[model samples]
Target chain A: MTALPMEAEILTRREESPGLFTLHLRLTDSAAQQAYRFRPGQFNMLYLYGVGEVPISIVSDPREARHIGHTIRAVGRVTRGLERLRPGDRLGLRGPFGNGWPLGDCEQRDVIVVTGGLGCAPVTGAVQYLMRRRERFGHVNIVQGVKHADDLLWREQYECWDRMPDTTVLIAADEAGPLWPWHVGRVTDLFDRLRFDPAQAIVLCCGPEGMMLAVAEQLQERGIAAERIWLSLERNMQCGIGLCGHCQLGPKFVCRDGPVFSWREIAPLLRVRGR
Target chain B: MATDCTLVAELRFLAAADRQRLIEALREAGYAVHGPRVQEGVIRYAPVERIEDLPRGWRDIQEPGRYRLRQTDENRLFAWAAPAASLKPLVFPPREILFHARRDADGRLRFEAADGAAPKLAVLGVRACDLAGLYLQDRHFLQGAHPDEAYRRRRRKLFLVAVHCAHPADTCFCAATGDGPVARYGFDLAISELEEGWLLEARSHAGQEILDALPTRAAGETQRKAAEAAFRQAAAAQRRRLPGGDLPARLGGRLDAELWQAVGRRCLACGNCTAVCPSCFCHAHVEETPLTGARTTRLRQWDSCFTAGHSLLHGRPVREDTASRYRQWLTHKLSGWHEQYGRSGCSGCGRCITWCPEGIDITAEAAAIAGEEA
Candidate 1:
């Protein structure tokens, strides 16, 4: 059977920022709820009646099998329709698709997460997972960047992450006022303030393509192998499966082969224009 | 398998009059037979009841941006290379309702999937490139991690009868692609037409049973030789051949070449190349809801890479200009496709060349790029 959206009810809705909200959904069918399980960095195709479907990453803790959480930003027609949804409203959902972050590979190794603006939503699940099993991993470093202080999401959660043992949270803004308590520069500048052995770290970065490319290049200059750096990419997705050729980035289908890929695999294609 | 090969070797001659009997046999075996017929002054695939429905004594002149049908005095069943349409529409409809949802009496929504069973269909006069295209589509829709239920249902009930091309079109390059002039596999029954009669060869158990039911006599050695010579002539007559050696790698390296901009100037981004392409399978989804808002139906339609919306990540499109979109289509088809599917995406059917309004030939573009690098 191909991807068909199942009816789901919104259990709760929380607004993290203006035009950005998180919905906790439960599949009406109990059997389907049990069948649907996702890993961190995987996404679901959320559908609204009379509107279209859009791919959103699952931010809920993976251990919770009953309720699925998705962070959505009102950017397009489908998302704008989704923004009007209330706690009791119903919606359609399919997937838990695409390859997720390689959590197992980070075991016994120091982990570094670099994100910008709304890019943190996709990797939030991975961060939560790592914190739950903190002893299994080494140093946990998260570096986030935003244009202004108001753009920061999950502020309370970032505070909680900082309290965890052996964890480091670094936040930066391009233009900061008195209210902001972080460095006033780009995310790459924060890398200078932190200290870590590049050989022992696995870097996971997601943001605009230009930002991610800059981060990857800087990390490579610091002696990190290209293979150890992983990045999450975004593209126009219609079908969550690989059949629809819309999400193609060179040979890889962002919807299927990845929304997450190692830098080594996509480096050549990234250099080409329009690819 | 050995027995089936021997059955194939036991060739039979099907006279022009006996072709009607074959259609009758197919209908009697619970299949709705479909074939090419003249519609809107052009030959198109449609339901057929008899041999008269075929495009008999008709041939087409196809060039870049031009197609014209001319009447011929000679009587032949399969003279055209292919119509504007391929097996794509039959298996993957242009628009299909994936499912429907409606509110129930309890104020909860109920969903039901689309119908699964499809009618048994026997399509006659399928060209070799179309047969190859069908196999390629099978690898995509059926062999994937999540098989397309609708495509699988329709494909399961299909019975293919392939016809060897005796007259290659001006835009045809199937000989270079190693896909045509003769049907190799993926067909139940294949036919090679000669001046005297049609030589029938069955390649499957079901095909053997159908051949047994038909009234046919053993094909003579002279008839077999004539069929072989005709296929050879068709292959030799091809005017276009893709440049040899590592096409995927060569095209990938030329992403910054100036040739794409020159081609993009003439290219209208009209999506006709992708629409006529036998292997293009991109699609977009749409939802329909009545004023009542009680029910919603989700449907999928064919999409093309030439459109600006094809690469929309958020509100912004990655390939915002015509040059980039054209480059994406060509690079994906000739170069990137090999990395993803382990095979070249183009079947070299030349439909893109003939149907292109700007007369842009892929073979010529590839040659120009390849020659510059060499």
Candidate 2:
């Protein structure tokens, strides 16, 4: 809640892809770290000391309260600077902000996580949450799509999830290579093989708006109620809190009201261009 | 001490010359008094010591994209509709350092929260519209579950002196917004400026103390009537009005009106309207580091929706064109604000109309979007 950033040391770092990486951070103030709690879909305003901050989803499990993980794509000014950081390098962090995915509503119901491109990071935490409490849910299905086959980052992690009982991991590439083993075409193409009872399913989605819209349409046509489908939207989230006005969409502050919202609550707004 | 019963509705009269004494009393109480003064041909809030510091014997002639101050034979303070900006900067500063991060030789990064302790400030001659704007801003920064500490620290020390408008600008529509002409709330002392002296009413306990300390007499029936008549005339004189009631709903449905495109063609996307808007709270966090890179200062500077960077996400601007930007600002101010703050964001002070280089009249634009003539 404090606007001031707290110092968090980079405990570990991993290069997920050429322009994508993950940084495991631990708050220097152990007491503050212990006090910090975040939901699966929520994000943190990660600051690169001398550079500005960027809103990145927390990829670590909420159960691991002290250790926080953020997978970042070096696509902007702040993220490009963060790419140079290594273990033991310290940065500023302020967060555990925005409404996360609706895991509580997923109890005893199928949890379908849909993502596109680098959008898998936000949902990865939720998928991990479901994996830890595997017995409580009906089924787990993760469907991800990328522009190119080589753009996929977490192949091993998806393979690990595919081995879990009552869980399905399907990945697709728009431009498939000769050696690509997954399905070809958009994430919508993988829907035919996805296993879930649409009537009793909760779809958590994050990605490009076009992809999400297509996914929502596909799910609705397949009999999933609009209210059961949730989406995490991204905007210019400068302040983790709602005070900064950049992230507003219609009446909602994407950073506060949601990074995740029910399709029924946000569907009408998605139709408007340049909102 | 007088009984508490009469404090709520009591009115006192201060002689024209005694205004300086009131400023002195506030200064003695450790408040830095700021009032409207002409600076660089525009009236803005600045430090004031004597009555002469106020923009006396001056009235602003305001129209769409135009503002000019003309000297008047009669001497009166606060005859203008509004200053170039409201009291927003006094509480939420245009630029503020949130915190500082320093790097040590051993690669240890230490962050220190900026000391946000603010000076006790007393703003004089505030208008009803400005007060309404401040009230909405208070909801934005303080009423939330996680109140902004810096804004709270500054807001807690403010001593507001409200002034009922006796002359409204042609561009003003506070009357339509239901926030102006008469000072109703959010002030320690509400003043009704008259020709001979000033009629003051205490709305808060602090206001009563200042009223008691001043060389004031109980206002006669004639003075009270004059005060009411002045405020009434001000309201009736307004040539502009922003239609209320279901405006938020009405405007929400008109987001795609081609009028926005037309307005966009003329709109410069300069953000002058937001800069002068009393309730605009958008800011950008900027990091400043020296060439040596030993320390970094993170500061939040006032930002506008018109800027392409305001809606930038992954290098893509959500509102890529001026029309969309204008739509975002107008829709948010009229409709989106109601959903967020439970009311409209505009105070209808008309600074946006007067100060915009393109002279874009929000009232006219809103009317056009609603399929009405300006």
lDDT by residue for model 2 over B44-144, one digit each (tens)?
Answer: 89999998999888899999889999878666898898888899999888998988889999888888889867899999999989999999899899887
For model 1, residues B1-374, the per-residue Cα lDDT tens digits are: 00011124667898877889889989999999999898997777899998889988889888888788988877797888778788999998888888888876554767779777899999998998888788878877888788898999899899999888888889987788888878888888888887656889898887888888988899988887777777777887887878778988887778888888888898999999988888888888878998987888888889989998899777777888777888888877787768767777777788898889998988898888766421
Model 2 complex DockQ against the native: 0.78
Q: Which ten residues in a row have the lowest lDDT in candidate 1 chain A?
A: A192-201
Q: Give the distance in Å from residue A98's predicted Cα in candidate 2 to where it truly belongs.
A: 1.2
In order of appearance, the predictions have TM-scores of 0.97, 0.97
Candidate 2 clashes between residue pairs 3 or more apart in a chain or in different chains: none
Each prediction's whole-model lDDT (CA): 0.85, 0.88
Candidate 2 at residue B343, lDDT? Answer: 91
Per lDDT, the best of the predicted structures is 2
| Model 2 chain A weakest lDDT span, ten residues long | A1-10
Model 2: lDDT of residue B321: 96
In the predicted model 1, the residue pairs found to clash are none
